[model samples]
Target: MQMMSVSALNEKIKSLLEATFLHIRVEGEVASVTYHSSGHLYFSVKDDRSTLRCVMWRSNVSRMRFRLEKGEHIVIDGSIGVYTPRGEYQLIAVQIEPYGRGALALAFEQLKKKLEAKGYFDATRKKPLPPYPRRIALVTAAGGAALQDMLKVARRRWPLVELLVLDVRVQGEGAAEEIARGIAYADTLGADLIVTGRGGGSVEDLWAFNEEAVADAIYAAQTPVVSAVGHEVDTLISDFVADLRAPTPSAAIEMILPDANELLRTIDELGEQMGRRVAQILHQKEERLRREAEAIRGASVLRRLVTLEESFARIGRDLREVIRYRLSQFEGRISPLERQMTESVDLRLRRSGEELRSLSEALRRNDPTLRSKEGWAEVLSEGRRRALESIKVGERFELSDGRVKVRAQCLEKRPLK
Candidate 1:
């Protein structure tokens, strides 16, 4: 101490404190807590008797399940050490826990029960998963294992679906606010479905899901949501409020998809059933047609036609006989009349000829030859008489002359004597 420099003295003190407190547990009320931008956590631990400065490395801070805040009663496990450069003594806390029910935890539990009583977890409120979801929104840490698991499962089961990852913090201050904003953003992007959760962790690690803001956001989402937080045994408020809940991210995908083989088999079966029905209908129609044909063949249509033909033939024969009888009667009547007419005409002609002959004979009798014969006979008788008279007179005249001359001779002789 008399000859030691400041740096050497500080180093010696640091070595003494490190050796004195190897591992210890301290119970105190947290105060003046601060988180550096460097990712380290600093706080003061105070008991009734004393207070100590505590520092947790960024590595351990990253692993913490809960947020560190001032005025919270806590118990921590760490080692007391001296910082040689700063020449200060401090506690290095490796692990820490709240002494009672944490304020954040109390709030989470109260809100969860209230929402549950309002039927937020009711099966009736849950929506059905789409048969084929084309777009899926994811609300979780971009770098976390949860997002990776979801991608793997979605791609394996339904590769055709589009994935939209909305990266946001899953824990710590303002983490719940970021998650709610992510859910709203996904809804605006027109995601068909949403899968919101994180990898497995303790109750405090998954406290973001228990947030009132996160639950309200899930309930308000227009798209259907699938909650996959922690392992199967772990349940968060988000799981109850979402449209569907799965034990893990992989299970969530399986819940939403249909088996391709099963669907194809169903289609084939329906086709076969339809084919059989159509064939049965056709067969029935064919049988009906056959029956109709047989009925037509058994009917008496041909017999009716033959009867009609016979009746027509009988009428024709009767008509021909009647016409022949009428023609024969007409001919007989006309023949007698024609014969009488011929006889009458011949008789009239003969009578006229006889009358003409008689008239000609009368005319001949009164001709000039008869008159001339009568006249010639009269003339011959008259001429013969006249010739006889003339001869007698001549003889008498000759006698008278001779007598007169003899008488005259007697007288004259007497006178002369």
Candidate 2:
């Protein structure tokens, strides 16, 4: 027999137990469970016959998806080893899973229950999207197909909305953390809406959106957040916590953005309706005026008013005809003068337009030609200038540009001023 110190005996036992149970699976109900402040997990698993002490270091605990609870049946995979200091044998667990379900599934149920109790999925807490969001931020993987899908949908729908794409990992390790950070950062931007999503994939691939970190960030965002992950059938934790849930990345854009073509069509329809309404109003007003006028005419005391109105109407018709005839004659006369003055045709037209406006006002006062200071003109007959002394009384001459042509009999011969 070999004699050994207590420390050496415990060391030998540790080496023997570790070598014998290098890889084993133990299934039992959890008994005593403690999550140490040092980040290690200490627990015991027991059956009816025996109880086994178990310990998982912080490194392994960090990788676990679900929390362990006393009385829950679980299966731990690890090797048995001796704690040399305490001279006790224990199971140093490397991995743990629920007895009959996948760890991820159990984790999903647990987190969903926990967050649901916290009112994370309350519909009243979710924000309504702006009817016409001017700026939208997309939190997604920059190079992923999901980003491309969203971009295409947004461009096709509302191209005027400015899109800010924030790149982040959407899958694999550290993806949830990146997604959480991306959401929080996107909220700082003054985006009217924020969309975070990825393309459809397997459960493992889409697990980042199921993470609690992502859910927490989505809940805390100031901007309206839309979770668009996986297919219509696939729901995630982030979707529940987001302000809105879209079935897919492309669907998110379709849901939030107003279609440009649809808006244009609506505007055109409204304009047509407005024009029709205005025409209807004018027709109603005109009919009312005619009825009122006829009623006034029926009264003998107002009969003179009807006659005066008719006279004014006739005068207005005659004045309009005279103006038209004068304008036609001036078109030929003004072209030559405009060329002689070295003025642009547009400049002449603009000045003539102003003169026409002034002429309309002068017609109200029975004045036609009011000479401007710039140019002078003389009456012409058969392409020759006619002096006032050479014309007879009651002989009519055409006026050009609303200016009066004088007849010879109107004035005696006088020296020029």
Candidate 3:
């Protein structure tokens, strides 16, 4: 053979293979299908004798209707190509179809059915997620993007959540064993919930989710497990066995974290409501006090007492005035009576003095001395007459010194003669 350049030979081989297998269909069973983080599907197609490597770009994978799994018998339409760098022939699957059940499918179904019969999927066996988890254990790769995403989401949602991260292999050899150990350790550490998952990947990349040990560990966990594996369309045995399933690692975080803003808003609203209720109660009490004050004002004991006192004082004044008036009238009547009595006494005294003076005058007028003087005068006249007559008759007279003496009886008889 003529010597050919490596690049030239590679080009010729690539052209020839592309032209020959441009529109060929191959039927086989799927094995080790892995969807990479780069959005490429890589797997092997195998039969009884041989196996071939295959790749399906994400653009074509989106068009596929069925979910692909390991050991699933399928028919594929693609062209063969030679990898110049590695010197390997491979198929670029353009279309895929499910033909029958694969070996891995039979085993998955058998295990699922056995567990279901044993009541593993029973509602009674399933555990509920805690309302407010105190601590959460994350079983995943230590520096994986899924861990960072979960931490970011959890911190933003609920910063107070205690995170216990178990650094372990999420995929490849011994991944399932490490994942099972992580779950057991989380339980021993008394975690509230276990968040285990990885970023989106192919079936082979997420094969740890299919491990019986991982599924059994999740199922046996006392703490609730939340499985977040692969894309939304991907389902794993761990998802069925776990207490809860999330579509992505971020979704698992959201499921476990509480919204801080919503809780704060609720607390604020409760405070406002309590304040309003208290204010209303105070307002009612104030109104009641006002009504009581009005009642007291209307029938005040002090006011009544003052009114009674005033009435009593007025009555006392009136009584005093009446007594004074009566006394004045009595004084007026008594004073005149006293004056009249004094005048009457004076008049009677004057009358008695007048009567006494008249009696004294009569006694004085009829005194004996005056009567004797008058009688002597009369008798003297008679005697003088008689003497004159007797002297003429008897012519007898006795004279002694300058006095005359006359006889009484005999001289009277002579006078009469």
Clashes of each: 0, 1, 1
Whole-model lDDT per candidate: 0.80, 0.90, 0.82
Misplaced by over 4 Å in model 1 are 1-108, 117-119, 122-124, 300-417
On residues 74-164, what C-alpha lDDT tens digit does candidate 1 reach at each position? 8888999887888999999998877866645645666777898888878887887789888888898999988887788766666788988
lDDT of 3 by residue, 1-417 (tens): 799988788888988998999989999989789988988899998999999999999999865545678988898989998888766789999988777644345556666776777766776777899888889999999899999999999888888889999999988878989999999989899888998989988777897787778988888889999999877898888888888889999999888778888889999999999999999999999999999999987887897899999999999999999999999999889988999999999999999999999999898667645544454211123334333343443344442211233333324333233
Per-residue lDDT, model 3, residue 166, is 95
For candidate 2, the C-alpha RMSD (Å) to the true structure equals: 27.1
Candidate 1 to truth, TM: 0.46
Q: How would you encode candidate 2's per-residue C-alpha lDDT over 1-417 as one tens digit per residue? A: 988999999998998888999999999999999999999999999999999999999999999988998998999999998879999998999999999999988889999999999999999998999999999999999999999998898989999999999999999999999999999999999999999999999989999999999999999998999999999999999989999999999999999999999999999999999999999999999999999999877778667779999999999999999999999999989889978777676788999999999998787554333442334446666556677566566555533434555433233344577
